[model samples]
Target: MFGIFIQHHVSKPNPPKKLLCNEGNLLSQIDGKGTVYTRVGGLSCNYDKGTLIISDKSNRVALNIE
Candidate 1:
């Protein structure tokens, strides 16, 4: 009854509210606060290694650069 009504009204997924750029640069919102960020170098993430590493302009592993 009610389930059938919901099924018929299903809608497409909403578009992502975040934006991303090459080399691991991204802009997103947290707690309804908006933010934007940009990086000067490359970045990488290895799920198996359980790490998300980012680099600075000199390609150094700098997690505290900000």
Candidate 2:
């Protein structure tokens, strides 16, 4: 799956960040953890304590926003 994270700064606008994941099923959770599917594959994601985690079978990515 492909994920896009867009951050908008108060000073200006910037380009969005894109992430790609593979090999997972699409699922959604009410507790801030879920799997999203896109045209490419599936990605598992978690958001907790101002940090966001995105992963697949082969890769894991984390982003922190304040």
Candidate 3:
């Protein structure tokens, strides 16, 4: 099963962010629960490895924007 979370803002030109979580069975590799975590943003990235980087040095998993 694959799960993703996207953020939405009112006045922002682009979407808030893209949070992707993938979990499923492997084809023929490991016969166990597989999980992958990744973070992507619409126009800006809160994480440094993605598209954009933010100045806020916080690693909270959730965000509340209104």
Candidate 4:
């Protein structure tokens, strides 16, 4: 009698890349109710009511959802 054996390997998926909103290309989120937005790499923003404002030292953007 004889038998055969096989081996398999699996790899983990890469994490998502952090995004930034800039001039000529702004990142906007619609219907962002109850959603938490976080900025990676020391980026920060402010949110109030139905508006989201993300700004840096030189640029600023405001997104309002109705």
By TM-score, the best candidate is 2
For model 2, the stretches where C-alpha displacement exceeds 4 angstroms are 1-40
Provide the clash count, candidate 2.
2
> On residues 1-66, what C-alpha lDDT tens digit does candidate 1 reach at each position?
998878776654434454333445533232234564433234442222433445445564423222
Off by over 4 Å in 3: 1-32, 39-41, 47-66
- Give all candidates' CA lDDT scores: 0.41, 0.49, 0.31, 0.46
lDDT per residue for candidate 4 within 2-53, as digits (tens), equals 2222222223333433333443233433233564333343345666576666
Residue 10, model 1: lDDT of: 68
Estimate, for each residue in 13-62, the C-alpha lDDT of model 2 and write its tens digit.
43333333223332332222354323323667666587667778899878
TM per candidate comes to 0.25, 0.37, 0.15, 0.34
**What's the distance in Å from true for residue 39, model 3?**
4.5
Candidate 1, after superposition: displacement of residue 50 in Å? 0.8
Best by lDDT: 2
Clash pairs detected, candidate 2: 1-41, 1-42
Candidate 2's TM-score: 0.37
Q: Candidate 3 lDDT, tens digit per residue, 1-66? A: 122223334333543234332232111122235643234332222433342333223543333322
Could you list the CA RMSD of all candidates, in the order they appear? 12.7, 12.7, 15.3, 11.9
